[model samples]
Target chain A: MKIKTIPKYTVYLLLVLAASIPLFFDIKMPNKPVDSSAATFKSLMTLEKGDTVLLGTDWTGSTRGESKAELIAILRILMRKEVKFAMWSSADAQSPRCAQDVITEVNAMMKKEGSREYKQWEDWVQAGFYPNSDVAINNVGQDVKKMFSPKRGTDSTGKLRSVMESPVLEKIQKIEDFKLVIDVTASKTSDFHVQFISSHKVPMIFAVTGVMVPETDVYYNSGQIAGFLGGLKGVYDVEVMMDKGLNVPDKDGKIEVASTKVTDQIAGFPGKDNTGSGSKYYPTLHFALALMIVLVVIGNVEMAMARKGAKNS
Target chain B: MNLELYYALSKAAGVVVTVGLFSVLYKENKFYRFCEHLFLGLAAGWAAVGVWTESLHTIWYDRMMGTVDEAGKAQSGGHWIYAALLPVGFMSYMVFSKKHNWMARVPLGIVLGVWSGQQIQAYFDTYGPQVRAGMKPIIGTSGFLVPGADSGINPQVIAANVYWSQAISNFLFMFTLVSVLSYFLFSFEVKNKIILKVNIMGRYLLMIGFGAIFGTTVMMRFTLVIDRMYFIWNEFFYKTLFHGK
Candidate 1:
C-alpha cells in the first residue's frame, strides 16, 4: 500500500504514540486558576464549622473523570470545616451510590487524621435519588418535610424511619434552611438546581464538567450561583488550595494562588497531606492537551499540503 | 492469598481494559469491540439493577408496602394506592402497540400536567432576579476609568461600585441580550439598519460563546483521559503494586 493509503490502523497507532509519549517525560504545564474556581475555593474556606450545606451529587461513573474529582475536593473542604451536609441526587438512580462512595472515602481520610468522621443519618444523610428532577426539586424547595416524607431508610440504629426525621435533615425546614447548595453534576441538572432550588434565594455553587462551564457561567454571572468549579482544572485548583491552604503566604509573603485573598484565620491550621484524583490527574491532563494540539496542527498541515499539491497539478 | 497480589492483578486488568479501549483509535479490532461490548453490558446491567434497588425498591416498594415494626416498633401494612401505580406504569408500554398508543397518552398527560404546573412558577423564579440585576449604572465619579488601587478601602467593593465599568459591562450585556433576542424575530423584517447590525453582532457573539464552550469541553475531555492515565500510573502501578505510599 502507498504511504498515504496505509490503513487507518497506522494513523491510530501514530496518534496513540503521540499522546502517550508526553506521559513518560512528566512535563509540567503552568495553570492560573480562574476567578470562578478561586471563588469556589474561598467560599468553602470561609464556611464556619457545623454550618449546613446541601450537596446534590447527580453524577454516576460515566463522567467519573470530572465529577469524581469535583465531588472529592468539595467533600474534603466540607469535612475539614466539620460542616453538616444533606446529600441528594435527582439525575440518576446510581448517583446515590457514587455519593456514598465519596463520603466513605473522605470520612476514611478524616478518621486517619484524628478528625471527626462524617456519620450517615446524622452528620450527612442520603436524601436518595428521585426519577423526576424538576418535581423533586420543586417539592423540596416548597416543603422539605412533605417532599422527603416519601423517602424512607434505615438509620444508624438500623431502625426504619422517614428521611426527614434523620438527624441530618431533621432541622431542614425550607430551601433557605441550608446555607449553600453545591450541585456536582455531569448533566444539565445543574440548570434545574439553579432554576428551582435557587429560586428560594439560596446561595448556590456548581461543580460541573468543562462542557457545561459556559452555560453554567450565565448562572454564575447572574448571581444565581455564588460561584462554580468547572471541570478538571477546577478540581486541581481546589486540591492545590486544600493542600497549601488558600490565601496563605509562602516565605516570599506573596499570594501564590492570586485569585484568593488568604487571611490569618487559617494560618496555623494544617491541611491534610492526602491528595486524591486531582493531584494525580492534573499533570496527565497537560500531556493529553499537548498531544491534542499537536494532532490538530498535523491534520491542518496535511490538509494544506494536499490542497497545494492539487492546485499545482 | 496476598492482598498485594490481588491489587497487582486488579491494576493489570485496568491496564488491559485501557489498552483494549484505546485500540479503537487505530482500527476497530476484536479487542476494542470486546471492551466496548463489556462497557455497554456493564452499564446496562448496572442501570437496571440500580433503578430497581435505588428507585423501585427504595422509593416505590417501600412506600407501597409499609415496613414491619419490631417488638418496640410501629405498625406495617401495604398501601393500595401504590397498586394503582402498576396500571399507570403499564400504560407506558402501550406506546409499542399501534392500536393502543393512545393509552400511553394517559401517563404522558399526567406527567406533562404536573410538569407544566411547575413551569409557570419556575420561569419567574429562574429569570426574575437576573433581569432585575441586569439594570446597572452608566456613570461614575471615580477619576480612573477602572477602579484604581488608591480610590477605595475595599478594592472589590470599589470595583463593584464603579458605575463606568458597570455601565460598559451592562451595556454590552444588554446589547447582546437585545441582539440575540432580535435574531429570533422571525415574525417581521428588521427594517432598522442598527437593529440588523445588532442581530448580526449577536450571531457572531453567540458563535464566540459556543467556541469558548467547545474549548472548555475539549479541556474537560482531556482531563478525563488524564485521570484514566493517572489511575493507571499512580493508583495502579506505583501506589498499589509497588506500595509506593
Candidate 2:
C-alpha cells in the first residue's frame, strides 16, 4: 500500500512498536543538562543536609510519565542528602496520593539499596492538600505555621499530630524558614507560588511539564526562580546529573554532565541507581518522536507529489 | 490484603482499564464506554471525598468543632465564631434554588473582590521583576564572552559587565519584544512601512514561540503514551503477570 494510503490503525501499530521496541534494549542518549537543570541541581545540592524545603506536588496521573520521573529524581537527591521536606498539594486532591506512592516506592528502593528509609514525620511530613491554590499559597507565604497547624500526620508510633510538630516542619515558622521551594507540578500552581510566595525572598524551583517549559523559562530568566526542570528532557537531565555530578571530573578527568551555569563542584550518588523513569522512557520518546516526524514528512511529500502530478495532467 | 496481592490486583485492573480505554482506536465499543464511565465516576467520588477529607474536614470542621484525645479529653476548645463561615459557604449553594438564586452572587462577589484585590498585587509581583529584567544593556563592556563562562560560571564576572554575547542576546530580546508588541496594535491602522514590516516580523516570532510550545506539547503527549506502554508491558505484563520484578 502507498505510504499516503496507509490506514490510521497501521500508524497506531507503528507508534506502539516505535515506543515499545526501544524499551527492551539498553539505549543511552548522550545528554548535556541545560542551564536551568544545572542551576536547579546546584541549588538543591548546596543546601545543608538537615535543611528543610517545601515540596509542592501538584501533578496527578495525567502527566504521570514526566511529573513522576521528575519527582523521583528530585526525591532521590533530597533523601540521599538527608534533606528534610514537608510535602503538600494545592492543585489537586489526587496529587498528594500520587506523590505518596512515589515516595513509598523510593523508600522501598532505598531499603533495597541498604540506605536509610525516610520515615514520615522525621525526614518528611505530608501537609495534606488545600483546595484553593491562590489562597493557600498566600496563607503559606503569610504564615506557614498557621497554614499547616490544622493539618496532621501520623508519626512513628502512628499517632496523629499537628504537622507543625513534625521534625520536618518544627522550625519552619514562615515560608522563608524553608531553604527552597520546589514545585513538581502539572498545573498552574507554580504561577500562583510566584504571585504569592516569590516576593518573600525565598528561592523557588519548578519541575514542570513540557508545555510549561517556555513560560517557566520566563521566570528563570527574570531571576524570579532559581531554576526549573521541564518535561521528559528535564527529568532525564536531572537523572544524568544525579549519575554524573555537574563539573565533577570522572576518573579520566572529564566532566560528564558539564555546565557553565554553576561554579561549585557538587558530588552525585554515582554508583547507585540514579537512573529512573527518565532514563527508561527517554529513548522510547525519541523513537516515538522520530515516528511522528517521519509520518509528517511522508504525508507532506505525498501531498506535494500529488499536486505536481495533477498540475502536469 | 497482602501488599503483593494488592499491587498485583491493582496492576491487573489498571491494565484492563487501559486496554478497555485504548480499544477506541479500533472502533467505538461498550468496553471503552464502560472504562470512560468508570473513570468519571471514580474521579467524581474521589473528588467529593477529597474535598471533605483533604480540605473541609481539617480546615473548617476540625477548626470549628476543635479536637479531642483518645480519652475524650478536649485538646482545643471549639470556636463558635468559626461556624459563621458555614453560612457564607452554604450561600454559594443557593444557586440551585429558584427562590434564592441571587444569594449565590454574594459569595461569588466576595470571591471576585478578594481575587481582584490579590490580582493588583499579583500583577506587580509577577511581572515587576520581569519588567526590570527586560531592561538589559545593549552595550558590551567586557570581552566577547564572559570570563570562565565556557569553563565554569563566575557570578562575579557576570554581575560586573554585560558581555558582547549578552549584548546580542539582549538586543534580540528587545527586538522580539517590540515586534511582538507591534503585532498587537489592533486599536489603530498601521500605515508606516517599517512598523508594518515589524508587525509581520512579530507575527513570525510569535509563530516560532507557538511552534516551540506546540513541539513541547507533542513531546509531553508522546511521553504520556510511552509511560502507558511501559506500564502495560513492564509493570503489568512483566512484573504482575509473570511475577518478574
Candidate 3:
C-alpha cells in the first residue's frame, strides 16, 4: 500500500494552529538558562546604578521575535538596575525606531510598577543611526562624544539638543568610559563591534539572531565577548535567569538556579512579566519540530518502500 | 490622535502586510508582490532619509558648514575641504554611464584601500583569540565533576580546575578539528586508509553541524511566524477588541 502524505497546505495550517496555542493557553514551560545566557545575565548584574552603557541597537523590526524579546529583557535588567544607556543603530535605517518602540514598552511596564520612569536623555537617550557600521564603530572607539555630536535628540521640552549634551552621555568622555557595550544585533555589527570597539577593553556582550550563533561561539570561546544572547532560546534564558537568579538561596539554602559555576548569588525580579517570547515560542517551536521530524520519517519510509517495491517488480 | 488608537491601527496595518506577504508561500500572486514591492520601496526610502540624517548631515554637512550657536554666531570654523567629497560621490554614480564608468573606479579604489587597511587590524581582532581557544588541552587538571558542585560550597573554586568531563569535551573538540581539517585537505592526496576514514568521519560530522545550523534556522523562522501570529491575535485583535482580555 502506498503511504498517503498530508498536503502542504494542511502542514502549514497545522503549524499556524500549533503556534497560536500559547497565546490562548498559558502553559508554563521550564526554561533552563544556558551558560552564555547565564553569563549574559551575570554581566548585566555586575553593573551598578549610574553606570553608563553603550547599546548598539542594530536590528530592525524584522527579527522582532528574537531581538525585541532580547531588548525587553535587557531593558528590564537595565531599568531595574537603574543603569544609564545610550543606544544607536548602525545596521538598518529603522533600527533606532525599533529600539525606541521596545524602550517605550519597557518604560511603560516599569512605570506601572511604580518605579520612576526612565527619562529620555536623562536615564537613557537615542544616539540615532550611523551610515557606515565599521567607520561609525571605529569612530566610537576613538571619541564617543564627537561620533555622537552630529545627531541630536529632543528633550522632554521638545528642544533639539546634541546627544553629547544629554545627561546620559554628558559624563562619557570616551568609548572606553562606558561600563559596558552591548550589541543587540541581527547582522554583522557584532563583528564590527568586536573588531574595533573590543580593543577599547570595555566588557562587551551581544544578542544576535540564531544564524549568528555558530560564529558567536568562536567569540565566546575566545573571551572576546563576555556573553551573548542568541535567538529565542537565549531570550528565554535571560527571562528565566531574571525569574530565578544564579545561585540564589531558597528557604532550605539551596542554590535556586543550579548554576554551579556562578557562586555569587544574584536575585531576579520575581512576580514580574519575565516570561516573554522564549517561554511562549520555545514550547510552540517543539510542536513545529515534531511535525518536521514526523514528515522527514514519513518521507524516508515512503522512499524505502518504493525502492523495495521496485526491486521486487 | 490617541497614542493607543494610533498604535492599534499601525499594528492592524502590519498584520495585513504580513498576511499579504505570507500568501506567497501557498502560491504566487499579486498581493504578495505588492507587499514585497511596498516593503522594498519603504526600505529604500527609509535608507535615503537615513543616509542624509544619519551620515551626510551629521558627518559631512554639519562638519563642513559648522554650526551656529543659539545666539546665531559661528561656533566653529567651517572646513572647505569636506565639500570635495561631493564630487567623488557623484563620480561613483558615473558607473551607470558607459563613457565615464572608469571614473567610478577612483572612489572604488579609495574605498577598497581604506577597507584593506582596516582589515589587517580587523582580522587579528576577530580570529586571534579564536585560534588560541582552539588549542584546548585534552588533559584534565583534576578529576570528573567539580568536587563541591552539589553542596553549593562555592562552586567557583571547584570550577577553576579542569575536570575529566571538560577534558573529554576538549578531546572530542580536537578530534573534530583534526577530522574536519583533514577533509578540507584538497591540496594533498591521502592514500592512508585510517586517514581516509577520518576524512569520512569529518564529512559526517560536517553534515551533523549543518543539520544543527539548519535546525536553528528552522526554529528561528517558526518563531518569526509565531510572533506575527501573536501580533495579529494579541496586539491587534485581542488587546483592542477585548481590551486585553
The C-alpha TM-scores of every prediction are: 0.88, 0.96, 0.95
Candidate 2 lDDT by residue in tens digits, A256-287: 77776575677877789888999999999999
Off by over 4 Å in 1: A1-31, A244-253, A260-271, B1-12, B70-77, B138-140, B143-152, B155-160, B163-167
Note the residue pairs that clash in candidate 1: A247-A262
Which numbered prediction scores highest in TM-score against the true structure?
2
- Which 10-residue window in model 3 chain B sums to the lowest lDDT? B146-155
Model 2 DockQ vs. reference: 0.71
lDDT, each prediction: 0.75, 0.90, 0.85
Chain B TM-score of candidate 3 stands at: 0.93
C-alpha lDDT (0 to 100) for residue B70 of candidate 2 = 64
**Which residue pairs of candidate 3 clash?**
none
- A1-313 in candidate 3: lDDT tens per residue? 5655677898888888877876677666765577788788889999999999999999987899989989988998999899999998888888988899898899888888777779897889888788778978888987888889877777767766788888888888998889999999999999998899877889999999888888887788788999999899898888877888776767887665756444566788877767777777777777777877887898898889888988899
- DockQ for every prediction shown: 0.47, 0.71, 0.63
Q: Candidate 3 residues B82-117, lDDT tens each?
A: 999999989999999999899999999998998898
How does the DockQ of candidate 3 come out?
0.63
Clashing pairs in 2: none
Best by lDDT: 2
Q: Regarding DockQ, does 1 or 2 come out ahead? A: 2
Candidate 2 overall lDDT versus native: 0.90
